[model samples]
Target: MTDNISAYKFDWPPITVEGYKKAENKVIMVFNLDVRTPAKVDHVIQYVVGRTVWCSLNSPVNVNILLSFDFRGQGIIVTKTQSLKSELLRLLNKANINNQVSIDFLI
Candidate 1:
């Protein structure tokens, strides 16, 4: 068992995939967005809530206690090698979710 473990030790690169299904050239990616605080301007942050939130304005007082706000978003991306995966990647990375964005891929 110990010898076999050492033999199986390997790191897979981002461009490499294993156990992929035949005739399937695409892959699925999941994006998780979590926003803890509202945006500085009211109509700026419109992804999940899709509307101008009143608590977007920063104040000395804690907005959580003074007012209620919705801040969080999630979505999935699916595409093949021929499609524009870079566009989807740009959107996922550009989302201003207060450093609460994540992406996962399955092979």
Candidate 2:
């Protein structure tokens, strides 16, 4: 005798709960600094991480820092709401070294 088994994948909460589903609206923002010196890279990373932490603490929305590293002078931030992303972008753009930094959004 032989037996067959099958499995299926299920997504909890389903798509119907769109308003309460924060994950569906998650946004990824990538930043690249033009600085080549190690000190400059460190400074940029520090400033970004600091601002991100501050925002996360003070804001009601959720903020997830995907990655923050000096490698190639790049950083990535993920936020649950678009407003939070805009706030961070504005803060970063207002910095003195804004000219040396490039920001882009993925999805």
- How does each model score on lDDT? 0.25, 0.35
| Tens-digit lDDT string for candidate 1 (1-107) | 11122211223223211222234422222223342233322122233122101111221122121111222332222442112234323433343222222233322
Write candidate 2's Cα lDDT for 1-107 as tens digits. Answer: 00111111112222211122256333233444433454664455444545443333333344333322223423433442243345445554443222222334443
Instruction: Evaluate model 1: give its lDDT.
Output: 0.25
Predict model 2's lDDT versus the native.
0.35
Error of 1 at 53 (Å): 14
* lDDT for residue 76 in candidate 1, whole number 0-100: 23
Q: How many residue pairs clash per model?
A: 0, 0
Report lDDT (Cα) of residue 16, candidate 1: 19
| lDDT, candidate 2, at 26 | 31
Listed in order, each prediction's TM-score against the native is 0.19, 0.33
Off by over 4 Å in 1: 1-85
Best by lDDT: 2
Q: Cα deviation in Å at residue 13, candidate 1? A: 37
